[model samples]
Target: MTIRPIVRYPDPRLALPAQPVTVFDDALRDLARDLLETMHAAPGIGITASHIGVSLRVVVLDLDPIDGARTYVNPEIIWASPEMIVHQEGSVSMPGVSDEVRRHARVRISYHDVDGNSHPEESEGLRAVCHQHEIDQLNGLFWIQRLSRLKRERLIKRFEKISRG
Candidate 1:
């Protein structure tokens, strides 16, 4: 597996919605493997196809090695609990800064494996947060958009300062 370069923030491609993965083949599998390697290199728990400039609706998440890595193709949040939770969120695209993001405490998502087999999963806690965060990226919604304007602005400034180094 190759560690693909991450598409950093402010790249217009990150603002565009990703296309659903329709073909389940070796190439798709390779993409998944590459994503896993890239995420590990980024030191992020979750990442999406768009993170690597691939406009496909694929997500790779490795929240814990004990649970193993999970690949979700065309993942969509089918259910979200009314309860909310705040978790610190960051992006491979925008490294060096993170802020608390409010999200559903629990969520049920429908997606397919790389082999095209459909599956439904219910997640809570950090897993649930990761699901929402990555799905939003797939939908062209950056995590900072969920923060207050002031927070978003401040975070961007900090990110800019870091980027200049």
Candidate 2:
């Protein structure tokens, strides 16, 4: 599996909504493997296809904090509990900064497996949070969007300055 370049902030593709995976073929499977490799190389907990310039609703996450990875193809959040939890999150896409964001504590999601079989899973804690975050990326949204408007603006500016350097 090859590591794809991650699209950075300010890229228009980052805001463009991703399309659903239509054909669950070997190509799609390879993409999933590449995503897993990319995430592991980044040492990140999650990654979305949009990050690699693929406009597909696919995400890979490894919240194991031990030894496992989960790949989601066309993942959709089926349910989210009202209970919210805050966590400090960081991203390899944007280094040297972490942000505290409130996320649903529990969520149920349905997606296709590598074999193209559909399955549903319920998650909580970091798994739930990372899944939600990766799902947002599939929808062309970032964790920064959960922050206050002022904070979001500040972050964008900071990233812009950093990119200029």
Candidate 3:
């Protein structure tokens, strides 16, 4: 396992759609492991494959307190509760700032494991929100997109200033 470099914002790849994994090969498995390592090293709960310049529909999340990490390939949100909850969220790619946004309180996701076996699971609380956030990344969506127009503008400026430093 290795820590992969995170791609920062304003990178065109962040807006590019990710490709679906085709083969459950060794390389794919290694990428998932590396992603887990990278996420842990960042001390972040979630990471998307596009964040490392790999345009693949893969995401790794570690919301467990015991260092248990889960990798999802070709992840999709199968169901989301209508009830909404707002949480303060931030990203490693854009540090030192966070925003409050509303997201479904529960969700069910389906994805293939490293061995190519399909699985679906229900998640709630931070785990649910984190998974939804990462899945959004796979679809070229960022949390900032959920912000109001004014807030999004301010965040972009803040990130721009950070980038210039």
RMSD of each: 0.6, 1.6, 1.3
After superposition, candidate 3 runs with Cα above 4 Å error: none
Candidate 2 clash total? 0
lDDT per residue (tens digit) for residues 1-165 in model 2: 998888776677877789988898999999999999987887787888888888998888887657688889889999999999999876656755677889999999999987789999999989889888888877878778889999888877777777678
Q: What lDDT would each prediction earn against the true structure? A: 0.96, 0.84, 0.88
The residue ranges of model 2 lying beyond 4 angstroms of the native Cα positions read 65-67, 161-165
TM-score of each: 0.99, 0.91, 0.94
Scanning candidate 1 in windows of ten residues, the lowest lDDT window is 60-69
Clashing pairs in 1: none
lDDT for position 7 in model 3:
84
Candidate number with the higher lDDT (1 or 3): 1
Candidate 2 Cα lDDT to native: 0.84
Q: Residues 15-132, candidate 3, lDDT per residue (tens digit)?
A: 8889999999999999999988887787688898898899999998887778588889999999999999998887767766679878999999999999999999899999889988
Q: What lDDT would candidate 1 get against the real structure?
A: 0.96
Clashes of each: 0, 0, 0
